[model samples]
Target: MVAKGFTVDLNKPLVFQVGHLGEDYEEWVHQPIVSKEGPRFFESDFWEFLTRTVWWAIPVIWLPVVVWFISMSVKMGHTVPDIVFHSGLRHICVTLMEYSYIVSFSYQTKSYWGNTMHYLLHGCHHKHPMDGLRLVFPPAATAVLLVPFWNLIKLLATPSTAPALFGGGLLGYVMYDCTHYYLHHGQPKKEVAKSLKKYHLNHHFRIQNMGFGITSSFWDRVFGTLPPQGKDVKAR
Candidate 1:
């Protein structure tokens, strides 16, 4: 039925029959969405398999590396004010730009490609929002995309300044993924987390196209997609 601008097939199963979790490489190839037991692959087969074991741990591993990178850059005579707000909060501004760009790009991709890319990038998670394994982008897949962004950031900003901005954006992605997982499975102890959980769940089952911002609702507010206020956003 036409709930949003797009038509959704209500009859289709939320978790489609792909294969049993981790049966074989052949079974997992190209399966974007999976059941609760899933660690599905997107376009790359070998890399996804290679990194399947470390998907959830990506934030854990990468965040500390980002910290180290930032720390080293600071030690190289670049102050936090110099690296972080070198051009008056330019670092965070660019980082926000990157974050918004990725969110919009993913949304546009899902909109253009329909179910296939949707399921691959995001729809599956919405379909099975509680599935722990599908919450974050596996490092293998993330690295494939980060290479180009790395080059772009280098060209866009100074060496001393770029890493700080890059690290900030990287941290944003990590927060988005981690916050996403927490929203689904975490019993949030804070009012803010509880509120965000309510907001994200609304995106999944109430307002599909709105509230795309996971880490921060700033963009959603700016872009006029912050989910209708005062409307009931009950969990699905």
Candidate 2:
């Protein structure tokens, strides 16, 4: 029987099972897979807990860094050419683009690496979509990605501008993670959120290849991954 988009495979031993690990360790380690579940991999509770619990502190951890960068830039009289941070519209646009880039990167990794990368970044979610404990981005994983991202941003822009851009991207990530959890667990009063939930759910159930965006569908539309025109959408 299928529960929350997963089915147990009787033919195979659960992933992460090793000889002589004992029943208690075995119970905690094994995760069953459904029809579309990707390859099974070992997961450590210590690491898993660290990732799941870090969500609450994300804003506190990153927002101050953004403020510091902007303030320091202003103090040092450093600014990006052709872009003024004072403009509300510009801030919004930059933040959105950065956020969209992360989503695009995720989709591209899945495409390039297939199930291996998907299992690392996204397929685990697809396998156990409703598991609230696993909803947020792991800090360990983020740190690995951010080091390279930080270097990339630094190369592209001035110090003053890079922080703000990075901060915006950070905020974008926060939004994406929050929105992803919400779509799975939130009931929205607004039509936009309702629509977003519908779009995301379709990605999970009806068409896994499409609708990669969580915070917004802008990238999905741009990348031609928008769900099919007549694809059935269900809200749950």
Candidate 3:
């Protein structure tokens, strides 16, 4: 049975605590709070700090790696134009596949969740919309996921070719992460960014199910998940 006044204890591992809610986590998590901070996933300060990251760190740590990956392709005699064309295509395909997964997962997320599973996946973003530290994917988690991804691309191409394609995809990931942070925190004076910010926030505050596309609403339109606009509506 759930405690009558259950609240998340942020200073400890969250998975066990959230699991205690069983099916109640879905409804409990959607309620938003405006704070610059987020839940601590671990009690140990060292481990807990790994759960958070700043917005600017994305480009600093990854852009050089992106350049290095593309350089490998150059060494194999691939021209700059060929690399750009193929890499750009690969980037687009990866993006489409990503948003497609987001759309599917958006609809299929059940009311019952795995303790802190939903929080880890996306619930925390909704619950604490203004928490800038948690706004982007932490580098630690990204590094972990890249291992299998690094290997997967190798199967589809020779050793010389796979890293170049992966580099394109890496660039796409970097762009996606950077853009997600901007949509939340960027104050746009121009109309286009203002509109994009409005659209992204709509998914957070107005309709969580729609606007699964974070970087642009183009895929949302393609997937038929765009918010209904009679009242104006709008993710990362």
Candidate 4:
């Protein structure tokens, strides 16, 4: 369980009530709150609990879904290479899709267009970097997203490919969530873990716009958003 911390009133939109100092709202939101659990979001006890997620829940709930979808393709006679290629492709595509919702606005408009949505999505994580529950995507939200994606895959691909493709997507999501949690909380002895933690943390603390890649920096390098080398990067 995430360590107990201050709770916010869920009845009101969150960003407006807290941390929106008279100064710029954009700047305040990115100033990491640095607590295991940041202020709570819901007024009701049940919803407040549901919003925070445990890191292990990502694999526990989703791995079975991945297996089920991949199994469908296997039953349809899809070969190992076919599944592997499609799975990796699905992973890459999922990462790319994240680029859509990530935008920075100089003007804070949380009251109407920008407020509650940003807090529920990206801004909350930036503000509450240490909130373990909010670190990974909630399974409930993922399930809702999966329905359309599953149908879209069916619409686009043959029976042989669609299941594996969707399965790969589920796998990628699990990996992404797990990796994100580790990047925040795990101790890294290996070079790869050390590197990924640094890359992701830098995104949170130092350079907000760059280093968008979480599990790997390949995307950042390809897109030219990778944090520059040879500069002093201090952890706050």
* Candidate 4 Cα misplacement greater than 4 A, ranges: 1-23, 98-111, 230-236
Order of all candidates by TM-score, from best down to worst?
A: 3, 4, 1, 2
lDDT of 1 by residue, 1-236 (tens): 23223333334332222222222312122223325555344345764465243346877767986787567668667886666564335445644664464465343321233434445555456555556666777777778887897788789977777777667667766766677677766787777877888887776666666777665687777877777776655433
Of the pair 1 and 2, which is ahead by TM-score?
Answer: 1
Q: Give the worst 10-residue stretch by lDDT in candidate 4.
A: 1-10
Please, what are the lDDT tens digits per residue for candidate 2 over residues 1-236?
33334443534432322222232222212233333222334456664456353346666666676666556556666555422443233346644564454455344221223434444455456656766656677767777888887799789877766766666566666666777778887888898999989987777677666777777787677778777777656666
TM-score versus the correct structure, for each prediction = 0.69, 0.67, 0.88, 0.85
Query: Which whole-number lDDT from 0 to 100 does residue 45 have in model 1?
Result: 71
| Candidate 3, lDDT over the whole model | 0.76
lDDT of 3 by residue, 1-236 (tens): 24346766666666557756655666666667867777666668886687689988988988888899889988988888878986897789767966875655453233335545667767778878788888888888888888898889888877777767888988888888787788888877778887878887887788888888877788888878888974554323
Error in Å for residue 78 of model 4: 1.4
Q: Largest TM-score belongs to which candidate?
A: 3
lDDT of 4 by residue, 57-159 (tens): 9899999989888888888888888889999999888776654334343236534345556666777898888888889888888899999999999999998
CA displacement after TM-score superposition, residue 216 of candidate 1 (Å): 2.5
lDDT of 1: 0.59
Error of 3 at 135 (Å): 1.3
lDDT of 4: 0.75
Rank ordering of all candidates by lDDT, starting from the highest: 3, 4, 1, 2
